[model samples]
Target: MDFFKFLYRSRSAFDYADDNPFGISTLLNAIIKRLQQRRKLTLLLAACLCLAAPCYAHAHIFSPLLEAILPRSSSEKPQASTAATDTVTSDTKITLPTDLSNPSTTTAPAVELELTKQPRPPLSEPSLYALLDAEFAANRGNTRRALVLYKQQSFKEDATAVFERALGFSLNNEDVHESLDFAKSWLDQNPDHVPAWFYVAHLALKAHDYTLAGETLNRILRYDPRADLSEILIGIYPENDDDQRELLAALQPIDSQQNASLSVLKAGLLNQFNDPQNALIHINRALLTQPDYVPFITLKADILRKIESTETVLSYVNQARLRNPDSKNLYLYEIRYLLDLKQSQQAWELLLKAQNRFNDDNEITLLAALVSLDVEQYRTADQLLNILVKSPAYLDQAYYYLGISAERQQRFEQAKYYLNAVVREDLVLAAREKVVSFELLNDNIEGAINTLQLLRQQYPVFAPDSYVMQADILWQHNEAEKALQLLTRVSRKYPDNELILFARAQLLDDSKDYLIKRTLLNHLQALDPSNLSYQLSYAQLLLANNRSSEQGLELAKNLIQIRYDDPRYDNELQLQALNLLASNALATENYAQVINYLQTPYDVLPTLRSGELLLRAYQGLGADEKVEALLADLQQRFSFGQRNVNDRVQLY
Candidate 1:
């Protein structure tokens, strides 16, 4: 404690004043204070270097770190009296005195050392204060200042709390990438911290850096094998099949463990990807650990349902139900399979049994009501729905289905009242659409439009779809000009809305208004070039240019060349493109070209238009035998009811 005052000494005082020093403790304190006063944190710290002799050490690389840790105050400022930032205070050889006690050394110190019995904390004073100031700055909403302090605090010690605080602030600011960096820093100091690992996993998942996410989640599982992963799993939302595949790959290492929950999750994802065989492999892996796990069994049954017949899957579900009679999922699975087989009576009976066994089960009740409606048992369906409508959780679904029940009974007014009462975001659109359909049935065009307008106001996210529906209803009611005008006005408000643009394009092409194609269709195509509908519409517009338009032909040909070879391309869109090409050929009186395009469509599955085009091409080529043979095959298909040609054809 007495040695602390010598920390303010010059090099002469440090080398001579402690000649009859208390020991090494007093000598090292002088050297440490000398270096610290100069605001230099030397790599060869004086405390370590001064053990052999009275000396200072080299200083480099840690200057900024020491400056940050030094207390911020005027009194603590570097003294201008000392300019020598040297490692050794003197070149003269010096010897350490052996005396451990002296009257001068025992004198009252300039700074009192009040040593209380407080437990040692993780960080020293300066580093700890840096964290405190960092938090203060954060609470004051000065994020940049707080981050600087947090980073400074981290430099002095393995201050895990400071890294955690920085991470919290970064996340609060929605700076996901920064939060992830802080999270990694936190784990670097304390690798075993589960919460820090979870933070890393969450941020990695958000960035779609699935490889990092998988690695972090694997570390978390190693820390706590039974850790709850539901929150992390829920954050993953795959928007399409490709996204789902990526997410599945990310979860592979996690599910590879012998954990039933993880295995079931992977199996469920594989099933959704429609890889039923792979799904079966993972589900069976899960069942090995928890053979009678109801959800796992249910998933296995579902995966089999994709490959096996409805009856076979139902039998497997029935066997599982016998083993786990109390499981609600088994009952639901059996009922679904029964319904798929069109055994409505058996489904209703099974639902009744389920309802009795699980008397308070709302799911069984809902399923029963739906089955009743399917069988036209309207009174029974209404009774079940009346009960569901009382539950807060099921209120929206109840109202939506009750509306359908009423509509089926031709009680349109009551149905509208019920449907309009649905408030759930998921169900509201369908409910209102059903009400609009009722109005349209009675030639009530204005009422239908009003319903759609109200829907748009109630749910702005659905505004584009509502506007498209309104235009469709108007055009259907012989108000094509009004439909065109309504879409045009809406397009100005939502210029990027493809649905509105598509509807407007349809109206324009129908009314021979090809002039807007250059601006409207070009913008629409550029906005989402991958949208097959836009490509088809744009192709149709070009082909409408005197029927043999080269641009239209090239686009249609390019569409086929690019997408036709891709195994994942939508078959319907490919067929539609082929139809557009055949239509162009027919327009150009190139009968042979028409046959070339329509031949595949006719052989695979012909819509009326494709069949007609092929027939016309045969007749034009004067192939009487081929034309007669085609007629005989078409009549046979219609007679045997092998194919049902769609009546409403696309103009393209």
Candidate 2:
């Protein structure tokens, strides 16, 4: 009966007993039997009632419904209050059936639900679509709209991916201030992100905010001590000394004694700013920790050289060599220093030692070859250069040296082949000059002229030299008129060029135009008054013309007295001066004096001209036995179809 009444009140006020009295009685009997069998039947009945309605309005109905369905125990005490209260919190509210059996109505207290704040969940699929939209805008060059959407998404979720994308887009668009803001936001969220710190530093550097950039770099170094500062420092172009000092000040604090790389970097920065003294201090500090460090040793030597402390530079290099005897760089440095000191023999010896140690090193081999060439060991240089010709790094230099070695050996074809292969701008002119000479030596006059044309077309900087070479070739071939025309054309084009002027003068001298020759020589002397070669040439021309033989003889004597041991003293010029002196002496009939001047032994003498002059002096002295002995020796020394000494020299 109570269940029927409960259902009756849940739907409407209708009595099922009135409609079907027998059915109501049967249903009541079944419910009573089930309740008697099991006390949990009330929950089943309440669930059925809830299912049948499916739209309960209030949960308070459950209080009355349970009160009527559940049988109270005999010992259970009743509360004084007539109302029952139940509170529930869930996504959906469910109302229970109210009791209608009791005439005194059961009143259920209203359900009181409390709400509290909950954290927001992560962005879901819809947010991803929004991000895709942002990407589309960014890709379509709508940066303003894209930044708006990106900021919305980033602030909504603060994802690392979103932050990175926004930052990169801003930087790619050259919105440095926007990129900086994004970097700051990223760092704020992820303080330990090294890449974010680097981005900030880069942006700061672009903005010329050295302080922020340096601070950011310092943060990076704190995270990774081995990070290369060179990449960051490359963009930092300080405006003046004060700016440079400011940058140095910022870097110095980060350079600790334990970090040798940072110290070296700081030293390099200081050196770049022309503060080598301070750079030396930092380098020494680094060396104190790593005394045998090769780069530091090299840097120290370079700093010493910059200060003109040549001896100290050598000593530093030697110290480094002692520490690292097998270091090829130190050996090369010492060799270069020796070469700079005009110690070719010493340089060659050092290079030989280096080659023994680093035989497979192409740079070492190349240096050895160059030093060998300097010492006139053409065969050894040829072997080394042949090995280097296939190397990409040394190909041009190797070909150049090979050409020079072949030229030295008088192998004209081989010289032309190697010289043609050279392409480096610094060596190209020299190689072309050699090629021209080889062509002329081979009697290929057309080929020689063609090469000069090509050389002038390819390298205009050497056009004057090419013009002079072409003129010389024409003059050699007895095309005196063409030679003079070419010389005049080149001289007019390069009016101030001493080489062209000298070429024209030589042509005039060949024509015995002594006045014009003297004027040209005077102009050359005025152009470079200290050039000993020009002075000697002028003196020889004066002697040749017999204009001032005494004055020319004194000048020639003074020039011959110049020590030829110095490499700067041109051997060819000295020999010319000696010949001029001997010729002037012979003109004056100073026979004994001429013999004394030309009496330098044939073995010690460098030029055939000296021997020829000596033979003339012997003829002047009427020393028949001495002349016969010299002639026999010259014939034996120059044995390959050699001409007689009388034919070679003008025997007075």
Best by TM-score: 1
lDDT of 1 by residue, 515-633 (tens): 77657888998998778778777888877775767777777777776565676477777777888888778777899998988887788886766776777777778787877677667
Cα lDDT, model 2, residue 58: 32
- Residues 398-425, candidate 2: write the lDDT tens digits: 9988888888887878889999988888
Q: What's each prediction's TM-score? A: 0.58, 0.47
> How far is 487's C-alpha from truth in model 2 (Å)?
12
